[model samples]
Target chain A: MRSVATNSTARPDAIDERILEELRMEPRATSKALGLKLSMTEVAVASRIRAMEAKGILRVVAQLEFRAAGYNILALIDVMVADRKINEVAEALSRIDRVGSVTMMLGDPPIIVQVQAADSADLHDLIVNHIAMIPGVEQVETNLIIDIAKWRTGSAQLHPTSLPG
Target chain B: MLVDDVDLAIVKELQKNGRSSNREVARVLGVSEGTIRQRLKKLEAAKAMRLGLVTDATALGQTAAAYVRIKARPRHARAIAAKIADFPSCSFVGLTVGRFDIVAFISATSRDELVRVVDAEIAVMEGVLQLDVREPVGYAKHRFDLIHIP
Candidate 1:
């Protein structure tokens, strides 16, 4: 089996903080644009970014606007899987189409699954028909989202200063 | 001043349509445009509200995203968490009272990158005792579930 090596973990510095902040706001921003904003040369910005990526401090990704992409129905499903079959069920879920995020929870049934679909019918088919078919899945409960208060990926959540209380 | 019914109505509308112009929101909420502007500015200043930008990771070549749970030395939990959070892959990290001490989300463009993240990056965090990782196959719902205006 091919396994990646992990070693030499270290903390981040001020420059790292600035670079991460820029990427968080706009992941697709060009190195030159980022450089202009940070007052660093484009080459410098590029190298710093690459270094961070290498160090695992920064990752540039394209995040989908699922709703805009035509997936309208959103639901949070909590599943109670047989303790022994959690891995099996999780692997099965990973194979299902349009399964956005399958999170194994810490408390209770021990798994929380998040799914996005085109409509209620699509959601129904995925969960009732497909997900439930997995051998280890014992029980499932879903909460359909009515509104979104705060939602963003990891980087976007970081704010150096405290938010107004 | 405490937020009253009118202010609450304005907040609810803004939460739904963050970029809606003050004039437009005012028309919908039956408030003056100036009132909308003042409330919004106050919200930002008070840190009670923020504008969010959502994107597509798959469109940007991030084909893989997963959550990794790590059990670490209790004494080194905070230090390890701070270090792990520095990684871009560490999307959501929290000190949990469960089987795992820390949880993080990682994004990768391919199988190789995902493996690299698990093997080379997360495995090396100081004081980590054990690691369990899971890849999310689908998202049922991961939005902010806010209903009450107050």
Candidate 2:
């Protein structure tokens, strides 16, 4: 799987930002249509998009409602592992199908993960049979995601690529 | 919102490529173009799904991603998450169990920016007893792509 880089100082230019915004608004629009909106040639827009995607700079994803998918349980697992085996434990957890997002957190609980299960029984099975069994786990704390009351996606707004003066 | 079989098929197709034309989808599904159009319209209106171009913030320049664990009064957790969700830089905020009452997933252009978000915005929330910040180098699956066609 290609990993989209989440760390870099490189920023998109104004044209690229406009392209991103346009696509964000109309993800289903054809490149030809996007070109018309930007007043830039279709070839320029298409190539730029292709290049951005190849470099993980541009990503288009469709999100479905998880509850509708029968994944009623969503959670965040904060794990404290043996001092030197953080990556080892994280890597092992990532291999599990249920574990979604795994990252090395910078503080007390050095690792954090997002997991989903069919129901409470499955949640228990995962923790008891899967997570707790992982070697080097100094401690494992599971937090149920009570509600995703509000979630605003941060896209095309980080590290603003200041418009040229 | 358990979608019907046809709806699941449409989502399956869109999951593969959100940009698939309605006509093309209809043709592939052995249905009229109008049917595909109507179904898509319903999905859009109901907000059952979203089609958009998303990117890794790191690819656009600012690189750090962190999860802020907030210890607070239980009643205020959801309210606090909603407030943090209003922050433009915040991508996700949720009320969680265990070590923290709430978790806010926010990204920054740099280390300094991350710190400011933790200090100025999150730490100051009313009823918050304490806050913990943890940054992950990468995510194995940072997505909302899961589905159940039943």
Q: Highest TM-score among the candidates is held by which one?
A: 2
For every candidate, the chain B TM-score is 0.81, 0.87
lDDT of 1: 0.59
- Name the runs in model 1 displaced over 4 angstroms: A1-78, A82-165, B1-8, B144-150
A1-165: candidate 1 lDDT, tens digit per residue = 222223224334687668767766765466789899999999988777666544444444323234533566656566788745575676677566666555555445466766778898998999889989888788887756544322346432111111111
Residue-by-residue lDDT tens digits, candidate 2, B80-101:
8889987877877788777788
Query: What TM-scores does chain A show, candidate by candidate in order?
Result: 0.77, 0.82
The complex in candidate 1 yields a DockQ of: 0.04
Task: Kindly list the per-residue Cα lDDT of model 1 for residues B1-150, writing each as its tens digit.
Answer: 344576567656644434355788899988799988887667546544444433234324466766666789999777766676666665455555456666656777697998897888778877899987766654433333121111
Candidate 1 CAPRI level: incorrect
> How good is the docking of model 2, by CAPRI class?
acceptable
| Candidate 2 backbone collisions, by pair | A6-B58, A106-B134, A106-B135
